[model samples]
Structure formats: structure tokens, C-alpha cells
Target: MEFAAVLLAAGASRRLGRPKQLLRRDGETLLRRGARLALASGAARTLVVLGARAEVLRGELDGLAVEIVLNPDWQDGMAASLAAAARALAGFDGAVLVLACDQPALELAHLHALRDGAAAAGCAATEHAGALGVPALIAPALWRDATDLRGDRGFGAGLAQAPDGAVWRLRAPELELDLDTPGDVDAAIARGWLDPA
Candidate 1:
């Protein structure tokens, strides 16, 4: 199905003492890798939401040919970036696969599964944290709700409010692996995230 991908590049890695999105893994920085995946996955468009140190990431994404949105409120949290990206895809059909920049290991197949599932449900999410965490395929019907996401409360909370059994869950271990700490990035290196570089 045709769709867009929202890469969340906003957020300062206070724990890592550096911008996680700029962290290099196998020559390609996390932000670039994520954007490349979204693009390679056939996303109609890939909108990157940047915040805090957005300048550092700009160089890496220079020739990527992506739609970049600066989130001045990014320091506030992921919700702000989500809102920015949602607004970017307001008129697009299909769903938006929301990807956290820190997760370089998230497989493209995982996104495909969610997109396939969401082709009907208006919304579908990958299984993470024993439930759903992201890599979601949010159909256009819910664009308003997605763009209205506020504060730290986001689509995850909204999807949960689905009456009874309204959400489809896809099992994906990679979806749960998020690079939040220096140690996490170090661990990811073994997963071939850093490769020979």
C-alpha cells in the first residue's frame, strides 16, 4: 500500500550526552539509516521532524531528498514531533509508519506488516513493551487525531482508547529495542548497526 513514513529525529539524548540521531552506525548515521529504510520501503514521502541539535543532523540528511520539519517545541517530547509529522501528511492516504530515530535495528518487514494490517483498520501497531510501541500504520482517517497529539500523551494513548478489541498487534522484537542510553548504542553495534565503521 502507498503511504508516508514519519521519522522522529527530534529529542536530545541527555542520557547519551550526544544527539542519538547523529550517532554513526555502519557509516550511516541512525537518522540516515531510518530515513533510508522509510524511503526504500516505498513510502510516498518521508518527513523527518527535527528538534534540539537539528543542525547536526541536517548535514547527514543533506542529499536525502526528504521533507524536514523543525519542531521548536521538540524539547517538550516525542508528542510534539509526532504532531509536526502528522500535520505534514494531512492529505495523504494510507498510513504513516512512525519510527523512533534511535532504533536502527527496526526491520523494514516490521513496517510492512503494520502497513498491511492497517490497510483496513484505520490504525495498526507493532507489538512492543509486551503490547504496542510504534512502527504503526495509522490510516488517513485518523490524521486529525494523530496531528492533535499533545504533550507526552500520543497516538499510543489514543489507540488504547479504541473501544474493546479495536487494535491489531504485530509481534516484533526489534520494535522494542530503542537506543536511549550510551550502553544501548554500544549494544546495537553488535547487531551490525555500526558495521565495520
Candidate 2:
């Protein structure tokens, strides 16, 4: 099934005290890596949401075949970015694969799995750390619900609300290591998931 990829990278990274989107491993920034993975996943379109550090983050994505979506209300939190992506994809015919840049272990195969799973089950989400979460693929029928998300809530909140059996879950332990703080960066580096600065 055809689908678009929405990479959420608008957060200010307050906890990390640095733009985690710009974090590097093997010379590529996380944002760029995510965009590349999304594009390589055969997504019909790839849209990146940028807010805080928008200018610099946009630089990371330069020359990539992806759309840039600016979220002015990024300070309001993840939901705002989700809403922006939803608005950008209004009327789209297929599923929407929602992803975040902080997942250092994100890979194209996993994204493809989400797309394929969603096509078969109507929706799909990563099951890691004992919870359902993004990167998730939501069927078009439920895309509108994304616009109603509030505050920091994101696709994970919606996934949690879905009736059992409505969504397909993929086991992915690597996805559990999101870089949200200095310690997270340290852990990623120690784990060799990221290169030390």
C-alpha cells in the first residue's frame, strides 16, 4: 500500500540541552539519517516537521528528497507536530507512517514492516519497552484522530487507546533507546549505538 512518512523532529530537546536531531553517528545527523531511512523505505512521500532550531535542522536535511513542514506551535509539544503532519497529509489515500528522529536504531526494514503490517492489519506500531508506540503506521481511517491529539501526547497515546486486535504490533527492542537526555546520549555511545563526541 502507498503511504507517506512523517518524521517528527520539532522538539527543542530541552532535556538533552542540545538538539538531539543533530546528534551524529558515523558522520550523519539523526535527522538526516531518519529522513534517508524514510525515503528508502519506499514511502510515497516523506515529510519532516521542523520547529525549534528549524534552520539548522533543515540544513541537516538539505538535498534529501523530502518535504519540510514547519510547525509554529512546536513549543506546545509533540501533538502540534503531529497535527501539522496530519494537516499536510489531509486527503491522502493510504496509511501514514509516523516516526521520530530520536530513535537511533531506526532502520528501513522496520519502516517497511510497519507499512506492510498496516496494509494487512489497518494499523501497526512498534512494541518496545512493554508499550505500543511510534514509529507507527496509522490507516487513513484514523488519520483525523491525529489532529485531535493535545499537548505532549502523540501517536503512542492513540495506539494505547486502540481496541485490542485493531493494531498489529512488531517487537523491536532497539527502538526502546531514544536519545532524550545527556545520559541517554552517554548510554547510546556506551552501547555503540552512537559515536562518542
Candidate 3:
């Protein structure tokens, strides 16, 4: 499917007390790695939503082939970033793969799986921690729902509310490990998934 990729990296990282997007993993910032993965995932285009440390995080992306979208209302929550991305892709006609920069273990294979898995269902998401979550593919038809989202909520919340079997789910327990706190950083470092800062 010809689609666009949206990398959600606008959070202030309040819990981690730092910009997790700048976290080093395999010698590259998490934000950069996520963008690379999205770019290489066969998406015709990629848009990165930035806010909190927009300027600094923008530097992390450097020469990546992606369009940077600034979300002035990022403080409103994840939904605000999603809404911004939705607006940026207003006239798009393909699926959208939404990703988060905090997943240290996210890989290209999983991204491909989600895209392919969404071919018929029109939507596919990671099933981790007993919930449907991003690293998800949303068909153009549902793109409007993203713009309707409110504070702090992400597409996962909408997926959960969908009728049973409305969204395809991929078992991805590995994605449950997100860098949301200092302990998460420690865990990623101890697991050799991230380099100590």
C-alpha cells in the first residue's frame, strides 16, 4: 500500500525527566532511528511531529528524508500531535503508520508486518500489555478519527473502542518496553538495547 509514516516525538518526556527522543541506541538517537525505520519501511513519505524540544529534536533528524511538523499544542497530549499529523496528511489517500520514538526494540520487520497485516483489515496494531497500540497502520478512511482525538489519548484508545475484530492485532510483547522513566532507561541500557548517556 502506498502510505505515509508519522513518527510521534513531540512529548516533553516528563516522566523520564529528559527527552527520550535523544536517547542513544546503537549510536543513533531514538528519534532518528524511528525515522529511518519508517523511511525504510516503504512509506512513500514520512512526517515527524515535533513540539517539546522541537529545535533540538529537529537536529536529531538532521538529513533524514522526512517532513518535520511542529505541534505547538503538544502539551495538550499525544492526540494533539496525531491531530497535527492528520492535518498535514489531509489529502493523502493511503494508509498511515504511526510510530513512537520511545520503543527501543522496534524493528523494520514489525513495521512491515503491520503494513501488510492492514492490507485487508484497513487497520493493524501491536497487541502488547493486553492493549492495541501504535506502531499501527490506519487506513485513510479512519484518518478523520485521528483529528477528532482529544487530550492525552492516542489511537490505541480508539482501537479499543472499536467493535471486536474491527482492527487487526499483531502479538508484539516486545513493544511493551517503552522508555517512559529513568528506570526504563536503565532497563534498556542493562538489556544492551541503549547506550548509557
Candidate 4:
């Protein structure tokens, strides 16, 4: 099945004291790396939503084969970015895989598995650390719910409100390695989750 992908990278990174999207692993920023992973995972197109440092982050994307979408109301929350991405992918006929920019351990293979496993499923979310969340594939039928999200919450909120069997859980422990703070980045480096660059 054909699929599109959206990478949400519009947060201000207040906790990190810096743009987490700019965090690097092997010399590539998290945003760029996430976009590349999506592009290489059989997605028909990948749309990256930038807001906090749109201009600077755009440069990180450089020549990557992914569409850049700016979310002017990003400060409002992840929902804003999600809505912006939903609008940008309005014409897509299939599912849209949503991913965050802070997962330093995310790999193309995991994304490919999510896309493949999402075939005919209503939605497919990554199951990690005893929770189901992002790095999910939301079918076109569920885009309205995603766009309806508000505040700091993401589509995960909608997924949580869904009745049983509404969302498929794709077990992916790798997604649990999100870098939300400088300490997290340091731990990842110390744990060898990130390569020396």
C-alpha cells in the first residue's frame, strides 16, 4: 500500500535549552535524519513540519527529498504541527506515518515495518515502555481525528480515546530512546545509542 510520512519537528525544545531537532547523531541532525528515514521507507512523500527554527532547520534538510511545511502556530502545541501536516498531506490517498524528531535510535527498518504492518489497519502506533504512541501510521480515514487534536497533546490522545481495536500497536522498543533533554542525549551517547561524530 502507498503511504506518506510526516515528521513533527516544530517544538521549541524548552527543556533541552536548544533545538532538539538540531541534535546530531553521526553528523546528521535529528530532523534531517528522521526525514531521510521516512524518505527511504517506501513513503510516496515525506513532509517535515518546522516551526521553532524553521529557517535554520530548513538548511539542515538541505537537499533531502522531503517536503518542508512550516507551522506558524507551532507554539500552540504538537496538535498544531499535526494539523499542519494533515493539511499538507490532504491529497494523499493512503495512510500517513507520523514520527517525532527526537528519537535518536529510530531506524529506517522500523519505519518500514510500521508501514508494512499498517496495511489495512485503521492506525498503527509504536508500543514501547508499556505505552503506545507516535511513530504511528494513521490511515486517511483517521486524519480528521488527528487534525482535531488541540493543545500540547498529539494524535496519541486521540488514539487513547479510541475504542478497543481502533489502533494497532507495533512493538518497537527503539522508539523509547527519545532525546528530550541534554541528559537524555548524554545518556544515549554513553549508552552507544548514538554514533561518535
Error of 4 at 92 (Å): 2.2
Candidate 1 collision pairs: 26-194
TM-score of 1: 0.88
lDDT (Cα, tens digit) per residue for candidate 1, span 29-148: 889888887787678898988988888778878788789989989977878888887777767766677777777677678777777777666678877776666777765666567756
**Model 3: per-residue Cα lDDT over 1-197, one tens digit each:** 78999999999999888899999998999999999999999999899999998987888888888999999999999999999999999888888999999999899999989988888677899998788888999877777788888998878877777776668898987788999999999998998889988
lDDT of 4: 0.83
> What are the candidates' C-alpha RMSDs?
2.1, 1.2, 1.2, 1.8
Error of 1 at 34 (Å): 0.5
Worst 10 residues of 2 by lDDT: 153-162
Q: List TM-score per model, in order.
A: 0.88, 0.95, 0.96, 0.92
Task: List, residue by residue over 86-139, the lDDT tens digit for candidate 2.
Answer: 898877887888899999988888988888788778889999777888899887
Query: Model 4, range 97-179, lDDT digits (tens) per residue?
Result: 88998888888878877776677467778987756778998877777667788898776666666678777787777678787
lDDT for 29 (candidate 1) = 82
Candidate 3, residue 160: Cα displacement in angstroms equals 2.4
Candidate 3 local Cα displacement, residue 181, angstroms: 0.7
